[model samples]
Target: MNYELICGLETHVELSTKTKIFCSCSTEFGGEPNTHCCPICIGLPGTLPKLNKAVVEYAVMAGLATNCEISPVSKMDRKNYVYPDLPKAYQISQYDMPLCKSGWVGLSNGRRIRLNRIHIEEDAGKLVHDRGNTFVDYNRGGVPLIEIVTEPDLRSIEEVQEYVEKLQMILRYIGVSDCKMQEGSLRCDVNVSVRPVGQEEFGTRAEIKNMNSLAYMAKAIAYEFDRQVDLIQSGEEVVQETRRFDEGSGCTEGMRGKEDADDYRYFREPDLVAILVSDEMRKSIQKQMPEDPQKRLTRFVSDFDLPEADARLLIEHRRIADYFETAAKGAKNPRAVANCILGQMFARLGTEAEKEQFEVAVTPEQLHELILLLDSGKIRMNLVKSTLEKMLDTGKPAKEFLSEQDLAGMSADDLKAVCEKAVAENEAAAADYLAGKEKALKAILGSVMKATRGRANPQEAEKLLADIIRR
Candidate 1:
């Protein structure tokens, strides 16, 4: 009676547009409650909705980036629901005909997860419930969102995680959306079911909602599978329902019985005009689409001669990849540039939050120049990282900080003097070295590096040490 779990995910990524999907309201997040709302987004009387051209273009870009087949035509339908957050009592969305469909994202394991559809929709406002009263904020109303639904091709929790990571990276690379899960710009709802190993039909599926993180999604699915298996073993039938993922308890709790599609009573909007995407428009979007993450990953590995694992890590963020590309240009060692950026410069930037904060002020060009200067021996590696931190903290450029701190790399003459001084001081180690003690030479090299305060070129120091030892 072995049972296997089946999983699918529905992810909503808010488009990074300047305005609302069907109105002129600003799409900025964390604004004053209802400050960005207008008559149309608030569903005031006699207001007609107009689609944002940027929204449609972003959708097409996303579709192409994900290997989806962009539909020739699509239109918005009204999804009716009764929540205080929904000012219009209905959401404008795509139903039968969506923006794209039949796409697939291949995993590292060679398993392909099929995309059911990617549809555009308007996000609902938010409801902040207090002790006694619930307040409705129309700030989020009418914001553009793309709903990406995947087929039930996922089997284990690990597969779901890989599929999600790859998808998020692709979206970020294409410049379509920011896909920040913590800020609620991206959200996921997972459907999970289990069946006997040989069973042809799936068991009752449980839809888990409000899973904000990848770790939470995997844990929630794993917990649900265990709960279902236990029920089936005890001869109790699994009931379909909508469940909430409790972060504190790390378990799924029933929110309500699963609502049927008819519960929303979806219909076409009468006020808005139908969208007509011509071949020319589709071609324009296809041309504008940036390189896909997977494609870029492969290219980074081949073109830059990076290890596959290193390329993957570098490509995790668009800014990081851009920095690597810029720094590698006309440099002696692109691999060294990659290593210094990730290993030293980034580490000097501190935590993820600090890095993001620094990113607001520091450009990739600045970091690229720093890497080049350090790699070419224009500045010592240790001083380069220290100067970068000062540049970030004080808003000073790298060149200015380098001059003020006098942290430049040692000149060949200065390095030779330090190396000579090191050999003069460490007579015991030098004696041991000349007496056929190879290990003692390494100790003397360390002394030379220390004497120069890590400013001397390590290679030059090693050469000077060996020259002295041989003499």
Candidate 2:
């Protein structure tokens, strides 16, 4: 029997607020191990926690972006657990009521993942377990985090990956959080179960803890799916517990006993005041949201008349989308801008070495100008591409390189002159074209372009060659 995969994700995004959730400690990543902590964050005796107003606003903003309803009032509760990371014995988290609820995120496949709730919480410190002794780093102990939970509507690992990616993009676009998985600013926990294809009852689910990257999550899900299938096929039953993903082995191992909701012993913290969201505050936060990706996609297609795929690629990166719009200003060919950037510029990014090299080159604006130069025929396309590489290597402008190398587009007169010479140089090509040989047309054009060192536009050369061929 074919088994269907059911998956749900609980993702935590650390808000980009200047300070911690309930303390004045810095929330910045990569600080000295214990220096960013304060009395309230480190759980010093006699310290009381005060909620940060900005955290609530960011959570509301996130809610608005994700189509979640902002609750008028939400309170903090203690999640009691004894772990080395959390300096405070209990993590201050939203338990009974979250700041937002009843939301839905739409997927590209036309599936809607219903959001159960979104809540504010303080992050735990880091525990470095080495040499049989665990050391605590309290730097991240009280950082503000927004936990977003989705209903068990996801049925496949691919769907879960898509949901997390879309959510991350939304978070980044709204400026609520950076959502960088590498820095632990954004993290995910997945709950997965499998049921026979036609069975109504759900199988026992296992919680996969601490998947750092999207790639790892996908692989872990596939591995777990095969493992579960084999177990059930051999008459073994799956268990419900927390499991850890071993990056080395690419498989999950049972870690420890899993705690149910009742194990938390949750209760309201009397020391902290409850957060109340007013209508005005909600509207204010809503207005601050950027043009979401879906809306931007539609506008780009309508305004620029770009293909849906091209428009999606352009809008995928906020910087590239903005650059496309800006470059199209007073320019006729928005499509060219999209193609050049996505085709050429985007291929050069998203790597560590490339990122370091990019810092030493011209900005995106300069590259946009180079495209304009190519479109206007002020510079040849080949020269523009080569000069871009030079600029990337040496931080020089394309225009400067064009002037230095004299790779400007050949003038109409110069191109006509080369076309005349190319036709005269090869009698067989001329004779073949006159005999109605279509392939000879390309050979003649190639000769002219080669003679001009590819500085002449191929279209212009082709037109000139056809005119000369008729003579």
C-alpha TM-score for every candidate? 0.87, 0.88
lDDT minimum window of 10 residues, candidate 2: 352-361
Clash count of each predicted structure = 0, 0
What is the per-residue lDDT of model 1 for residues 142-212, given as tens digits with 9 covering 90 to 100?
99999999999899999998888888888877887878888888899999999999889878888998677
Once fitted onto the true fold, the runs of candidate 1 whose alpha carbons sit more than 4 angstroms away are: 258-262, 351-424, 432-439, 450-471
Structure candidate 1, residue pairs in collision? none
Best by lDDT: 2
- Which regions in candidate 2 have their CA more than 4 angstroms from the true location? 231-236, 258-262, 347-416, 428-443, 450-457, 466-471
Q: By TM-score, who's the top model here?
A: 2
Summing lDDT over every window of 10 consecutive residues in candidate 1, give the lowest-scoring window.
Answer: 353-362
lDDT of 2 by residue, 99-206 (tens): 999898999999999999999999999988999999999998999999999988898888988898898778877778878888888899988888899998888888
